[model samples]
Target: MPVQRIFFGWPVPAMPPRRIAVLLGSIALFAVITLVFTLPNSIPSGPSLGRFTDHKISLPKLPKTFSSPSILSPFRVAAHPPPVLKNTTSGDSKWYSNWNWLSPFSSSVTLDENRSLLPPLNERPPIYTYYDHTQKKAADLKAADNALLLTWRRAWWAQGFQPIILSPAEALNNPLYAELQTLELDSTLKVELSRWLAWENMGTGILCNYLVFPMGAQEDHLLSFLRRGKYPKLTRFENLGHGIFVGSKAEITAAVKTALDNPELKTAKDFISTVPKETFQVDPHHESVAYYDPVVVKNKYPKIDEAISKGANGLEILNKLIISHLHGTWRNRFSKGIAVLKPEPDHMSAAIEPAFTLAEFLAQCPESPMPSSCPPNRPKCSPCMASTPLKISTPPTYRNTSELYTIGTVPHPFTMAVLSSFRDNIDVPWIRRESSRDPWITALTKEVSGTGVSSAPRIIKFKEAVASEHGTFHTLWLTAEKEVPQDLDWRFGFTIPRNATDTGKSETPVPGPERRPQPKPDPKNGPVANPDDVKKERELLKRAKDFGQARTPAEEKLRGAIEAWNLADTEAWRFARAFLARSRVERLKWEEEEKHYVGGAGAERGKSSGWGRWFDD
Candidate 1:
């Protein structure tokens, strides 16, 4: 009966197998399509993805052995010949066997035996020799050797040459030559040897035998030796003159000129030439004429001609000419001669001494009577006209003349006399103290204090008079009259009265007492006082009464305001205003005190009235 409701269940429908088969087929197809598209797109491509085409050319094969003739056939294996073994019978066999067959065509060839392989004795290396063609010829082979040995010895004595050594037997036979020949030299020796050869046209090998050591035969021995060490002589020639061995005359001249161009060589030449002829003879024939000739030419100018003209006998003239030539002029020679002469005494002193004393030497000699010859002026003559011969006392000998002269001239007798006179007369008395005298007593008495007119006498006279009359020495006193006391009574006693008092302090009258104030008259009786006047009077009275009150409302308010202010504020402003008002009142009281009071009032009364009014109002 209660709204019967019907609930129905919907039945589940079964799916068709064909439709399911269709869906499955479609999904399968979709998946296959997706996989096909994605797999190809997602996969990464590699380096070997593209096909490679290499076009390499193949090389032909080489054969192991070669044929004898054809160039290509030589590389073929089949046509090659077999190796043959070398025979060991002769020396050549060992040589052939030792020869590197692998390097068959090498440039070098070794020989097993030295003697058999060498050339015949006739074809041996030549022996070089050098001969000296000097003025002193060699007497024999040993003598020639000795000369060469001496040259070598001299070379050794010079710088850059080394010592030579030899065996005792070797040293004994033509010792110097043997020693030279037996020398063992280094690369430096070889270079020096080469230089000597180039310089003297000597054989380098001969020089080497004498200067350097014996070495085994080497190909290009000379060239190798030269290469190892520097021949600075050659280098210097190449750099500064013509290259080695200046052969031509022009070349030799050029080389000489180039050498002269060097400042050191030129300076050396100048120095050598300046050397004396005696000095040139030091090394005998080996003297450097290159250094001496130019200097001699320069210095021996006119003298050279003079010497020729005079031959050897005109010695004085020749000497003068030589001196003139050396110095270039006669004046220069004269100047040098003057320098050589010892300096004369100073002319000033010499002239003064001759004028005054004549003991000092005169620098200039007197002219000779003949004008051709004169002796120098002698200081031996006496200066004083005294007929006695002058005795010149010589000072003790000194190491030098200047010292002697100094001691002799200074401290002269006249100078010492002047100094002694000055010391005794002028300087002695200036150092003593003076005497004192009584000035006051002498002056008061008006008498001459002493026999002479000394300053003490005068001062005493003056002081004596002043002290006697005035009790003090500084009192006033007349020159001619007697001194008197300086008092008013004494000066004016006769003209003025002596017994009178001053009378300047007279007694003043005493003031009367002050009268009482009268009462005010009725206002109506006084000539009918006007209303305005009455009003004015009333107003004035009112004002006075108001002033008389302690304070008006406004004044009180102002006072209250002042009182309300802090003490600090009062100190800043209000206290000052109040103090000023009180001071004005006090000032008025003081003024009244100073004045004469009118009527029956004294100064004190006026002051009291003023003070009372000021405070009451």
Candidate 2:
């Protein structure tokens, strides 16, 4: 008999089966091993687009661990019960019962008040107020009888998004108004400069209409200033803690009147003043601050009432009609993607103002000198015309999803304000917190199971297998960024006990309403060995969620410590389960590959022209 060869601590068997399994297993294990890397979720994933689009990665079937809490639970705190005082002497062994307040484990955690990335409270952006101005040549203003009409620029005449108003000081200091006094102002400069003076935040309103809801709540206030507050009934309402609101003029007016006239409409003294009244007048007399009487003008003009009398249900619809008529309904969500919004000059400035607002644009540059002719308080160009709309490019899956959806027919603003611009005051975390846990778990499980896996760790590996595809989707939608680099990596985030877990098996049945027979417990594939432990985990996660939704400061501190403990425990759990899954998956995969190879080429190779065959020949 030939002496068996020893190689790398493994006896190279003369027999085919043992040697074949060992050889393939080693090769497969070496192939599957990879170095682990962790990164912050906020790290931008942009810089690669086409690569993800070209080659689609296949998602693995996730394990049952990825199920909804009703089916399976991973790791999460479900409810945060206030630690009730309990007697350790009672035979009960719940975690909260063994309270030694001085014990390090029982110590509470606190959020760092100094940890906020938000700007200082005193440094909030100034609430913008628009100045009222008149339409037609400066000479034509003297002919308009209604002083409110004098301040008003009729919808057909103004090309910008909303109505314009100017202040008393602004009337004197602004160079645009001073230029209106000049006799030689060219027809073009006259139009451009003249349009510049007629500023209203209509573009901002159109933008508000574009968001799904309260995202535009603050800017929506600017609309009240539009047209010198002619629509007092429409503009003066309290938008307290309810969802976003849209209604006919009568509805909003009634709501506002009740809030102002009746005390009951007030909820939580949170309502700041939002009375609607004119802020400017079109002096029939040549440029003078003395003629600015908003009350006298409004009582005479009453533009909103006139519109309603003409069958315009309310000011919102009136404004919305103008917007939709001029620009299409862009509020409907289109497929998500990359778009570069370039600002276009509004009709008012098309003949007069350059595509870029020279004064405002130049002022942005470092050490750039302002033109002597421009006023100390130079007027801003229209947000609608000057803003470049965010022309975004959608990824493959998101692209096809919106194919059947309708969008605005009118052209998009060349330069449109981005959602970020409106929400600059908001701050996000260094480690962004998870948004919706259920959706993410569902997504991961579906991929891991392919159709179903028995364990959580396998589901995770399956997640890694299709990282590029699903990872990209999560990064994009999760971070709220438009695109991320093709190679971008992501991890889960937590909000409180300094962080954030999961457990459970399905209690429900399918169509017949009968419970499916439970598979016999196998050491290799059975229910979790400790059922109580899973229940405890589920309870802890529920508590963490409660802490996350904590409205007050006291409850929030306990939540942080709980979150940290949960996260640490979860990671530890994942490591153990994942290691097991990795070993199992590797072994199974290797066996499969080995079987295929041996039955085809490897088996023949391992047979090695045996001496028997030689002798037979």
Candidate 3:
């Protein structure tokens, strides 16, 4: 036989089956040992959006030194429990906890303090505006405006509304944006067109049946006016002064479709005019301010026009103004210190007051000796950080919390809001209460699991119906029931600690979560790990493993409940993606058919079939 030459580690000649098998076995054994030893130190995976349910659930190998605690044993706690942190100002820690860090829910009692800032879900109107960074003039104008955009957002946020700031780049996602790109319209006209197109995109696609408004950047709606419902309600299409128009989803979408059909309507203003108006009903009067020269209005209000005719001063004219559209002309006068408009004390709420006064903002400018840092007395630095609280009165309806059946509609905002609030907050690195359980957790788990049934259904049986011709259903739920417990027990154990904290410096660290100290760098020996520290870490890891291995009756129940809801929630997201993807494909197909009918020889036949009848089907 020819002498076999070794290339690297293996012989050049093919090894015997027995030898190869033995080598593979040895490698596998080593991997198993390494994984077992390192698993305790490994971090749990973060939350993922898609393909959550289909993935295989693997149980992590227990550490070599891990001692399985008794089923009745309690969780291991720190030797010394950290002192309960107190608020000196309030003298009660309960009030601090009530803030519900970044959560969208609040108690009915604290509604005014928390949920008062933003309108509750279904009530919050989207204030749409456009910005063009490509234009030098517009860029310079916005840049020099000194936090005008920030102030504008705060103004809306204060009134419980979130403004949607769109740009030409953002509009690229809209299918209609392609048409805008094809046309070479005037830059100014294009800005207007792009804004409407983007708004139409949002109204039709995301927020169906929702009312949306387009407002100028410089324009500000009085908080009092909005609270009092003074803003114009459009039955068809009504201009609410200062070029602001509010319309329903159908009306706006119809207008945009008309624009796309008619090539003559090039400008955004033209699209607004295309919006169907009620011929019978008269247009409402829109208030305008003539505080300074060159006052412009969409429809003149008797009060404002009369004041201007009587030669009313800045303050007098300002009082009568409901929505102040301080465009370039008004802003220019302010910049040159030519015009001054001030409101009375009672009218303060009625005016478009920013989070901070202009004087306070100016004091903290870069030119000041002590800049960049907020003044000790002033807390205006971190504006718009308040959470948009949930409307407790409107709990998730039965449709959303219905389990065992697919609803085809997404989970209610209330259900989502509750999930967002409690998911992170309630995760404590401690044992479940032996006596009583949290009502919120019990309710939420049920809601989420039920919601998942509708939102994320296991459509494996019906795969052929919903599945695209080319691709099969993306992800199906895990078939085996045993996998759930193993996955939850091995992955999260008892609880995944919340290591994050709020912005307040004086606030105490989140209780129960331990932070490991990093190894210090030495001059001669480079980074050196302390043997004692390493030993301590191993002990802690062992203790943690023990705590997880041994679960109380309550803990065991809690773990199972958590696993059930979590799996359902994961599946819900997975199903939603597959469902939406299928819908998109169907939409594209319909659009193709529509194009063929519109442009092809079958135009008359398609019209006879009925416009948009296919979509309804």
Number of the top lDDT candidate: 3
Model 2 is weakest, by summed lDDT over 10 consecutive residues, at: 492-501
lDDT tens string, model 1, 104-196? 111122322210111111111111222222324323433433333333322221111221212222213321333223434444432333233
The positional error of residue 475 in candidate 3, measured at the CA in angstroms, is 52
Tell me each candidate's TM-score: 0.15, 0.21, 0.27
Stretches of candidate 1 exceeding 4 Å from the true structure: 1-57, 60-131, 138-225, 228-617
Which pairs clash in model 3?
A: 104-390, 118-160, 119-160, 456-572
Question: Please, what are the lDDT tens digits per residue for candidate 2 over residues 535-577?
Answer: 4433433333343343366444433433342332222222222
Q: How would you order the candidates by TM-score, starting with the best? A: 3, 2, 1
Segments in model 3 whose C-alpha atoms lie over 4 Å from true places? 1-123, 137-140, 184-187, 204-242, 266-269, 275-617
| lDDT, candidates in the order shown | 0.25, 0.26, 0.32
Report the lDDT of model 3 for residue 300.
Answer: 32
lDDT, model 1, position 70 = 54
| CA lDDT, candidate 2, residue 70 | 46
Q: What would the C-alpha RMSD of candidate 1 be, to one decimal place?
A: 62.3
Expressed as tens digits, the lDDT of each residue in 326-364 for candidate 3 is 111122212211101111111111111111122122112
Lowest-sum lDDT 10-residue window in model 1? 114-123
* TM-score of decoy 2: 0.21
